[model samples]
Target: MEGRLVLALILGVCTAIPCHAYYSPSKPYVPPTEKVTQLHFFLHDTVSGKDPTAVLVARPNFTTAFNNTPIPFGSVFATDDPLTVGPNLTSGVIGNAQGLWASTGQDVLNLVVYWDFGFTQGKFNGSSFSMFSRNTITQTEREAAVVGGRGEFRMAKGFAKLKTYFADFSTADAIMECNVTLIHY
Candidate 1:
């Protein structure tokens, strides 16, 4: 009976003892604010020569050439027209009409132009050129163009304008087009 009493007393004392637990307050999370800028690009052709009017047909050729080239991630390539340059070099008729598009968001603040004819299959024999212009309120005005043979030619240009806070922006003119050397891989 005495042993039982002692054991009960010991168990009671053990159960009554307090245990300390460690804890700390959680820190508040904060997000950083990012500034966004937007810009629009327009490509058109304005040439006095016979090849200048060939832009319509050249657009599709350009698109085909671009599609055949390997593009890096986070970048895209496209064109308003998707047809052959023309039935023949002497046709003097433009078939493909030009069009434009706005970037998905304000993430694209700089414009980089690239031409890939290195993979062109035949030799460029035709004489043609393409012209383009850029217009912006807070940036310097600029123009770009390229002229090359009908077989295999490669040209690239890059343009960067001042960043703007507005979401609506566009170029003053359209991009130009010319003959491209098609490379068969």
Candidate 2:
């Protein structure tokens, strides 16, 4: 009977021991506040002029290009078009939209694009932001996602709304106005 009581007491004492050395609670982490910036500009793309800003870089098979549809599928073009302050080319030059765009639609007019806006003469000079999007050219308005950026727009995430300011089907020249809103440091 005495041995049983001693064993019970020993067990009870062992169970009451503290375990701070093996486990410690952690504090919650908080992220820093971010700021937002809005930018407006225009992009001029010329594919038929002597000094065309956009050039045909790739195309699909010959049979595919001459398909029943008027629109060519899998046609890729590289562009280093100018970004201006206004819809007109004579407006202030701010940046260049350097990237590639591809016609992905087989029936209608749809283009998948990736562009980098490299600023030159502005408050965000030397800074650059990137965007990737699928634009339905038949529509009046188009939107693209601003994936990333560098310099003043570091870690930028946002969207850009583009409207066709001018277009010449005969010459394959277009001017688009872009309104961009983004969040950054």
The C-alpha TM-scores of every prediction are: 0.22, 0.78
lDDT of model 2 at residue 18?
82
lDDT for every model?
0.31, 0.85
Model 1 / residue 101 / CA error / Å: 12
lDDT of 1 by residue, 106-179 (tens): 23233333332222112233322222333222234433333331222223223333222222223222332333
